[model samples]
Target: MPSIHKNIFTIAVVAFLFRLLMFFFVFEHSERTIRPDTPSYVRPAINMTEGHGFSGNEHPPFFPSAIRTPIYPVFIAFFYTVFERDVLIIAFVQIFIDTLTAVLIYIWGRRLFSESAARLGGLIYSLSVEQAVHAVFILTESLFTLFFLWAIIAVSCYREHCRLRWLVSGGILIGIAILIRPIALFFPLIGLLFIWMASPNMRWQFMRHGIIFLLIIAGIVVPWVIRNYLTLGLLKVSSISSYNLLFYNAASLSTDLHRISQAQARAAINDQVTKELTALGWKGDELHSAQLYTAWSRKILFSAPIRYVYIHLKNDINCFLPDVTDFLELIGATQGGKETLSVLNQHGLIAAVNHYFDDNIWLLWAVFPFIALLGVTYLGTILGISIQILQKHWDSLRLLFLPAAYLTLLPGAAATPRFRVPAMPYICLLAGIGIAKSIQCYKIRQQQRTPI
Candidate 1:
């Protein structure tokens, strides 16, 4: 086999086996695989396959849902129909998709940097604890990551070749990704910016291409918006954004102000919203309720705007923290979250450290490797980005850095390592470049020291 083909094959095998092992380990502890939101996805999927249409009402009448998007649930529904509603089957499919994503990361690295960098990037992504754990869970992260990766790769291709076809492909992939997870809603705008930056001299030409790219994304997404309008009477792609704003974003802010737990703040806000709605003679419909939630959330979030911004930016930092619980939870090393982010949110950073050692001191040996890998990756990313900045490597920044920053920042206070999955490919690629560059620098220094 050619060297490139051999490297790709090796990466694929390692990724497959690693994810497969993690899946089996989770299978042995099946309860750990199910999360609070698992039912939201799985139940709607099963409802679809059972002829109830796309609903997650969890009761008779099975009303159509406007909260979650269609593609991911439909993706799940197809698997449930074929595989008899087996979670393991769904996990296996995710593992296969994630493996492809890992290989694509290698391709992304090769395009941006060197052969060795791509190989290393692919390996780092494959062995990621976050990637492995989320692959086995009944969540959108794994599948969304695949589409997200392709979408970004398509953008890079368009940047290099300035081809209309690449824009169309990227639009389609990003549209699919948005359907799977609404967090990608603003990414198309970023794509346009990247295009504009890529060919600054050809402003008018790139602008035309940018508009066409956006139109393709709109064409893909508008049907879903129309469906939502006709069915729910709401002109929104998904109601999840409102739900997150109320429960997560607002709740986090409330927690900081009230000095109460997030759960308590959520309950309090729920009661307050319910009372206000009742007082206003609310009809208790999904559309009006979502509108109310968004309004109330914005009110609360903006009431203490400075504090909310502080909390949002502070938690953005949490995106990079290593959470070994992804593995430890499956292997039964710990129960619930004693993660640094969780404790830090509740009791501050000092307390978070104390709590980690206090509760799971014995697991330090297992956790160290994940933390070390995280540190190394971040160090490498810093180096890689530094080099790019020094060289004025705008393509690398546009392709990798912007998306990473956008994905990392957009999650706000809800940021977690799981939320970091979409950004991992770019980060790993940058780390690979940094490592490769550092080695080259070291070799040069060594040669200079040696006798001629």
Candidate 2:
């Protein structure tokens, strides 16, 4: 085994080099194309700087023009203040964060498993095309993942030593991460449950710790609610409108449907669909320009809730499935998306080879089978560890399991590969233990077989 510092440094170098190569060579041309939410963030941050009250769409004051939390944009704006609003620089910063996340994954894995497993996990994560692609785009997923990983690290620290301050620190990180992305609100509560389940005899102690944890979380969140109230005159906690929109429009016609001008019946249906949302409480410039995106979403839900559920599930699955061809075109390896198939035909052999590899990267989903194998191994390790804890009656392991289970189960309903990435270190750690245990058993059997 290598020294811990050496292992970390090696992983960092490899991860950084991989990400830097992708940032410079691959996404160089693609970064200019504004991502889905880029304008929303840039415009609102510009508005905020201009001293305008938060007047973004269906979202609360917290998100403003951006559908995401404000922290990452604020960080981006700080860079813009210094370096000018070069999308390249912003993209580079995101790449750096993505690399940092890889480092964190390695460190967390090392603690949970062994150095080799940590290195492997970090390398796989660093080279992941999905992570690399997303990193180049200006979006919340990369930044949100950084904070999410930090929260997990904080939880691991708290598990190692029962310190109130560590618990509070973990709570605050979870709080900020949730603010960044509302779905994270489940973390601290999950942590608390893990703690309680781990500590049966220390019930009173756990309760006190939980109370302090909640207070720390509330301290961070309550002020944001206050700001939202002052700005919007609404008593909402965080941004509820986005969720409403997602819930409502989870099954609407594709935004591209408007392009088919010859289909008068389809166009009429689209117009009626547009009007249906405005007829609801959806108002304001954002809704008007965006055509009551959330309101329209809600209308879809109201019309057929069950159908919407099915559609969202299908979409989530599709998000995970390999779309190598589309992704290749997205990264400019193919001439498919912008040009007709006839035009692509004119490009000849070299271009065809590029297109073939680009379009087929979705085959990487094949890795999911290996990941699932690791997951099963991790489960067995967890069970074995749980048995040990039960025999020893170790409360800390029990506490750790609570948060671990929460993080695992919460995302199962909407499982995308990226969504699953944040949990990879934990999974890898468990898998590493399983591997280590098998080796130990093998060595023991060989020792028993030796005859004099």
Candidate 3:
């Protein structure tokens, strides 16, 4: 095998083994593996297999799902249909997908940076606690991430080769990714902008390519929009965006305005929105419900636009920070997820940290190293981006930094470490370059200091 192939294979093996161990560790904690959103995906999969189409009958209203797109539930249905409805099989599949993503990260780094950087990028992603943690959960992150990487890789290939086929492939991959997670619906625009910025002289030619790229993405996404309109009477891709805007973003602002807990804010908003919707004679009407939420959230969001922006930016920062609680919870070190969130809402972030560590002191010690590793990784990413900026590596800047920046912002006030999973590969790629550059700098300094 070539050295690059051998190195990537090793990284993939390590990633697979690590995630396999995590699956075994957390599979027993059905709550942790299934999660709150797991049923939303799984039930639809079960329904699909039972010939009920994409409708979810979990709550007896038998509503067609407008919040979740079809890709992930369909992914789950495949496993349930072919292998019996064992969630373990689904988790195992996610583990394999995540491992493949790590390999792709290596390939991406090699295409964008150096071989050493590629190897380091693969290793970094393989050892990522967040990536591995999400793999064990029956969430869209793993599969979505796989498609997300493929999309960007295709775009990068298009940039290098100026091929229309690569643009079409990128559009298809990104469209599938959007179905898996609607957060990426605008990513095609980002890709188009990158292609334009990457090729300054051939602007007109690339413009044509960009249009074709976007048309293909629209071709993929518009059908879903049509389906949503026909079934749910909502003229959008998914209602999840509107739901997040109201429940998470606006509720967060409500917490600050009302001086109450997040749960209380959600309750308050729910009551107020419910009464308003009822008065409008749109109760249980999915389309108007979404429109009402957008209006309510916009009212609150615009009332304190600056405050909301601050909150959104703060959430973006949190997206980069290490969140070991999920890992701890999985291994039974922490008591439960709610306790920590409750403490945070009741007291503050510091109090929550103290509460978590005061009880799990030994586990804190165990988790410290991984936290440090994450810190180092972020530092390296910063340094690497700085290097790219100073060197005027626009392609590297666009490919590595733009998506991370976009994903970081797109989650808005809903940002969490979980939301950060899709950007892990890009972060690792930049970190690899940064770490490699730092080592080279150190070696040069060492030679300069030695006697000639």
Candidate 4:
């Protein structure tokens, strides 16, 4: 078989089989452990599809809510309108999207590095167990990852080709992604900074693309912001993130005290939260209450500056850990989380060299190697990005948008598996490059040692 054909076939088979396992078997856990966010999304989707409104009126007397954004629920409604809202069907759709993500990663790697690196990166992404597991959830990660990857690709294209179209498209996509999850609310600003910092020689080119990109982004987001303002008197797209701060700081406070349950602490805050919000002129609305809770969290945090430092340090490290369980809860794991852990244990190719090796009990099993690989690739991407920035490697600096996104989320509350998945494709690209470079070095030394 031809090399291109061979590579394509491998990618196809690997993507199909791995994701098929997730969609068919592994995803049973998702249905079994239905997450709280699932019903929230489903209720809004049903309302939209049935001509009610974007109001999350799961119950009869449901009113308009500015809490959840409409993009993801609207997407679900689109599918429900055509056929039905089956979890299995959603799994299949996500599997397909995830496969295409692998192909995009391959193309991105080819453009950024060598063709060999591209293939390796694509393969690594296809076989990434964490991502496969993530697809099982009826959440925002799969769709968010898709658009995020595409936007990065488009932005990278504009950098290479100097086309305003790619920049505009990237901006529009960012707008779409924000509608699903507000994580990218600040991404346009980050992107603009990246553009200006990217190429000192191409100031005119950067200015043209940057302005167009920002304008289109503003066009996409301003309407939602306006709607939020008019309806809730708040100039925000969604108020859901206020809870992240609330919960994170609440958990941090619990840990500092060392005897209270985070859950109990959170529950206990309700009466005090109501009091605080009422004092602050809050009219007992969900969004306003969340604002108060967030403020209350901040109050707690600032009051104990030393403890705040310790909590933030811990949160940052935990947020980046491999095969983490905090994310498992977001996906609604239940006991399958332990099963997932047991399944992830395994030794590496270095261990394989010792063919007679037995007693795997001494080795780190299941998810350890996957976690180790993730750590290495992520750290490599960080190192590679630092080099790119210092050397003014303009074309590649845009890739920093993803890890930056993850980093912003890190200091907030908790780290989960899904949080890390978005950054994996680019990290894999760098890892593949590192692996290829190592192989090249080893081969060169072997040639030098040849006795001619």
**Candidate 2 C-alpha error for residue 20, in Å:** 0.9
User: Candidate 1's residue-wise lDDT over 1-452, tens digit each?
Assistant: 99889989999999999899888887766677777778889888988888888888777888777788888889989988877777878888999999999999997788788998898889988888788888888889889999998998888898888888998899999999999998999989888987887765887888998898888889988999998899888899998888889988998998889888777888899998889888877746778888999998998998899989999988888788786656677667776443456578877767876675567676878778767888888898898888888888878866888888889998887887777888999899888888888988999999999998
Which one wins by lDDT: 3 or 4?
Answer: 3
Q: State how far residue 167 of model 1 sits from its true place (Å).
A: 0.8
Instruction: Kindly list the per-residue Cα lDDT of model 4 for residues 20-118, writing each as its tens digit.
Output: 776655455556324557777778889887777777767665566667777888878888888776766676787888888888888777778778878
Alpha-carbon deviation at 173 in model 2, angstroms = 0.7
- lDDT (Cα atoms) of all candidates against the true structure: 0.85, 0.57, 0.86, 0.68
Q: List the residue pairs that clash in candidate 4.
A: 344-366, 344-367, 345-365, 345-366, 345-367, 346-365, 346-366
Q: What is the lDDT ranking, best to worst?
A: 3, 1, 4, 2
Model 1: residues >4 Å from true position, as ranges? Answer: 278-284, 337-342, 356-358
TM-score of each: 0.95, 0.70, 0.95, 0.83
Among all candidates shown, the one with the greatest lDDT: 3
Extract clashing residue pairs from model 1.
none
- lDDT pick, better of 1 and 4: 1
RMSD (Å) per prediction: 1.9, 7.7, 2.0, 6.3
Candidate 3 lDDT by residue in tens digits, 19-39 = 988988866766668767888
Candidate 4 clash figure, as a count: 7
**Would you give me the overall lDDT of model 2?**
0.57
Q: Say which prediction, candidate 1 or candidate 3, comes out ahead on lDDT.
A: 3
lDDT of 3 at 303: 92
